[model samples]
Target: MDGDFWAPPPDVSPPVPGVSEGYPGVSQVMSHGYFQHGGVTFPGLLYSPRSLEAAREFPVEDDDVFNVTYQKSGTVWMLEILSLIRQDGDPRWCRSVPNWDRGPWLETLLGLRRARANARPRIISSHLPVHMFPKSFFGSKAKVIYTVRDPKDVLVSLFHFARIFRPYRDPGSLGDFMDKFLQGDVPFGSWFQHVRGWLQLRGRENFFWISYEELQQDLRGSVQRLCSFLCHPLSPAALDAVVTNASFAAMSHNPMSNFSLSPGFILDQNRGPFLRKGISGDWRNHLSPEQSRRFDLVYRERMEGPPKNPSGDTKIPPGPPKNPSGVPKSGEDPQGTPKNGGDP
Candidate 1:
């Protein structure tokens, strides 16, 4: 986990590109302080077109490991687990290095450089959907560990996350946020699309799926599965160390893992800690009965699409946009003709 690679601190004034107008036939959310780039929505102040272009062309090394997830779906947790596994369950690397450095978010400009510069067997993380991911990753021997969570929980988490996160505006009332979420208006685009798109990679030799619910229920088992997937098994004692350090309590307390070390301008820890409750079903407490029902309808409708075949393809509602040739296209976002681009 410890490497000679050291990423520079993010720019005090990071480059936020001037986003172009949304293209025709795509789902564009230029509102809510977000912007459309290649059919996906992103925080305008955080990401740039140059970084995204780099991501599209990043030459994925065969020995690389990718930690992929949608927003607020245990992204940092997975990174910590991977770090521990790389060191055979040593916490020293995890304690000293911030989570972003552990494996930079590949969508950012700094992270893009860090990922490209890292040594082989690198740990690269991203929140990008399949269409937007590096094109080279498709046939590479690289391994991907994707984290899925109940979108309802993701909704609750993202709502709070936007409050303190400098790039996002206050997510507004929970009810309003729910409506926007279902519409895929928030950052990183739609939760349904993200999960559905990545789930399509299941059953591939190099792809492994770990749901937040499953991990919360049996972390040890999940860790074991990860070790098996990565082909880096730990001794029982070492495995114990990994589990102990990666626990929610331990992570929350660690400045490296938590966002406590972040500057106020970037992450306002005063407003909320990045690591909130680690348990599942917290959404139940926050969502009204009506909200829950609506969530269920959307989730079931999309996730329960045409049965997946051996190749892992399934027909999904609002399925990933493709080129006219009828094959999935890389390096593009949804086809969009935007009516407006502001959060109303």
Candidate 2:
């Protein structure tokens, strides 16, 4: 979270010869799934056997709360919000520790013992899919908050994130990245698969879903709802503090919340801030019209056929494309893929 989860410390493994100073084979590491652990394969540059083994044995307390999402989908934002709630709006205390350390990434293995040794109500984060979690976690009473964003925006964000990391190459253009994203060639695998796997568990008593668009549209309201779900309802002033502290401007400027102060997490701060442009529909700025149309088609196909509700009705229905300001009404495309058009 705070530090580079992908870049293990020198003690984990010696730097590969002829590669980057810390990590080796920048392009090759991400282009293929070369690291295997616990009978699963992951992107080599981002994961290691030691970390995965720790993930396999990671303990999940009854009150443990996990903020799970694919990379760049408001993870830090959620971390800040959850931190504020847990700290009762004590900005000073919240700022005392880095957000990543407050809610350590479950898969990184780095600082995990510190996270466990910390206090009760541990807030953990992970980009791992449902199946990758430790076997005990599934049966535990731990709560999980799954965050999702529009696939298009996710691709754009991931593209920019790759550019900032030393282990990833230029990643070509937005089109190339979009193709990799669609084919599940990038880290954490397919966005569709990740969302779908979590959606399947949507009905679980301990599971909750939060859309990035929903957070954008109503941060305060989302925070309240999350608080209620976590059983940590806040007062008016506390809510305001959480909203203010979690804002893009506040987080971007605050090194404690943002990863800016964390070296190795971001390769070059001059290039861009880690909390860059926290908004919806940013895909419109980066993706071409044809690319958008192609992506829409793939999204519709992958998201077709909704999961069922208890009453036998479709949990989600086909609907029109979402406007930039609105959450996607449904993952399905009711009228089929739209023609090459402007941002939705």
Candidate 3:
């Protein structure tokens, strides 16, 4: 189970002498569940050094649509919209297949295999940082949809998420999680680093940058824009269908979309639903005044955001930075032929 993977922060340091399976509600994550690569922390239960390395080398067909996001940053929601768009606003697929399987992840071995074997116009998802993404992506015409959310909201969502997601070590307390989050100790590493690194690349023709607030405020408009970017425009009727079905209230009731299909060991449904409140600004309710002040201070200090961009969930600056930084520098692509699949 340990053939090279990202080492989650909870157990980065040596574990206590006698704590079996880690002390409950403590910060010690099991060794088997993590792996480290290029100083980034990934939940390793589904990943491996070989797997991640392979994904980096995977052949990225021009038809690939990567939904890249940090956790709880509208990852699932965006998938839902994309899935509906792929289906031309049909709910049949959305109601049958789980979103993860429908839009597989690239960091995990399973996702890698599924993707390699998948047909064209595949919807690939990932939480990987830019420097570690698939190498072939740079040379290919694969379109990427990157979503950002208010860090405060992300913090609140991830805190509750940790409670229900078994792969994550207990977040301890809100204060503890906040300390680790600000310090880049959570899964997928520093929010500041992840966002800053990707922000530098928002200008690319193939990349579409969107904020969670934009989605919340105008889902229909956002979906329309995504549809346009995908070059798969939908009719007014079809577009309306997509907006209605992808709504939080609509998706919450859909067994396939809400991740209700997840097994008990993977997700403790009794503790909470996976698609818990799908709104923005919920952080205000969870963060205390002092905590908010502290978070704002850290966010402002860490993020060298575009000028005049509000600190948290910094909006994408009007235009791409002078020299946008995206796609990690690497050697040439492998000789393997990328699999082909038609539009979904």
Which one is best on TM-score?
A: 1
Model 2 stretches with alpha carbons more than 4 Å out: 1-46, 305-325, 328-344
Worst window of 10 by summed lDDT in candidate 2: 1-10
Cα misplacement distance, residue 37 of candidate 3 (Å): 1.3
Candidate whose lDDT is highest: 1
Residue pair clashes in candidate 3: 4-49, 5-35, 5-36, 6-35, 6-36, 7-35, 7-36, 120-341
Q: Identify the superior model by lDDT, candidate 2 or candidate 3.
A: 3
Pitting candidate 1 against candidate 2, the one with the higher TM-score is 1
**TM-score result, candidate 1:** 0.81
| lDDT, candidates in the order shown | 0.72, 0.66, 0.70
RMSD, every candidate, angstroms = 13.2, 11.7, 12.5
Per-residue lDDT of candidate 2, residues 51-124 (tens digit): 76677578789899888898888888888888888987778756778887899888875756666877988999
**C-alpha root-mean-square deviation, candidate 1:** 13.2
If ranked by TM-score, best first, what sequence of candidates would result?
1, 3, 2
The sequence of per-residue lDDT tens digits that candidate 3 reaches over residues 125-224 is: 9988766677677777899888877788789999999999888888888989999898888888788767665554544557776767667767787787
What number of backbone clashes does candidate 3 have, counting pairs of residues 3 or more apart or in separate chains? Answer: 8
Q: Residue by residue across 1-344, what tens digits does model 1's lDDT show?
A: 00111111111111111112222224344765576766678887778666777887898899999999998989999999999999999899999988888798899998988887776779999998766788788768998888877677789999989889999878889999999998887778788667666755644667776667667867787788788778887899999999999999999999999989888878988887899898777887898877787776665555555422222333333333333432211112235221111011
lDDT of 3 at 316: 33
Cα lDDT for residue 124, candidate 1: 92
